[model samples]
Target: MITLLIIAAALVGIIFGVAAILPNDGYGHRPVPRSHVDSYPTHNPFL
Candidate 1:
């Protein structure tokens, strides 16, 4: 029926929209660390 077709199309759109928004971090990817520290260090040693 026309109703069934509309439901199917809506589901497909939701799936594609979610996929586009999510991050694509792949397997075994390591995050890079900051290259340099803050120029003016905080007075609090705990920081």
Candidate 2:
């Protein structure tokens, strides 16, 4: 019974640790995808 309680506590600790380590935008919004930004051309050969 004690071992089961310890296991459950360890699982909870791991979950909190993982959540803290994850990256987050200041506004709680995910950053735009790389592919979306690449769609707009930054340079033109004729320019």
Candidate 3:
């Protein structure tokens, strides 16, 4: 049980470290491309 807690703590630390090292695009996240969004069909049946 103690080992499990330690492993979980280590994983959380690593995740935060990686996240901190990632580039910030000012928006805080990468934007989805327009082609990806347009590929999905719209749900409006009345149109």
Candidate 4:
């Protein structure tokens, strides 16, 4: 049981370590491109 627990912990740690080392591109907060800007209306009546 202890060995299984250790293996699980190690796997979790490795996953987090790898994720932490990778580069991020704004994490989904990137700005919209100029080309798609005109698709949405300047003013929305629903809002």
Best by TM-score: 3
Q: Cα lDDT of model 4 overall?
A: 0.45
TM-score of predicted structure 3: 0.50
> Per-residue alpha-carbon lDDT of model 4 for 1-47, expressed as tens digits?
99999888777666544533455222443334443223434422221
Query: The CA-based lDDT of model 3 is what?
Result: 0.46
State the lDDT of candidate 2 residue by residue for 1-47, as single tens digits. 99999888777666544533456322365434542223323321221
Which structure is stronger by lDDT: 1 or 3? 3
- The lDDT for every candidate, in the order shown, is 0.42, 0.46, 0.46, 0.45
Q: Give the range where candidate 4 is weakest over 10 consecutive residues by summed lDDT.
A: 38-47
Q: Write the per-residue lDDT of candidate 3 for residues 1-47, one digit (tens) a residue.
A: 99999888777666544543455322466424432222324322121
Worst 10 residues of 1 by lDDT: 35-44
Note the residue pairs that clash in candidate 1: none
Worst 10 residues of 2 by lDDT: 38-47
Once fitted onto the true fold, the runs of candidate 2 whose alpha carbons sit more than 4 angstroms away are 25-47
Q: What's the C-alpha lDDT at position 33 in model 3?
A: 42
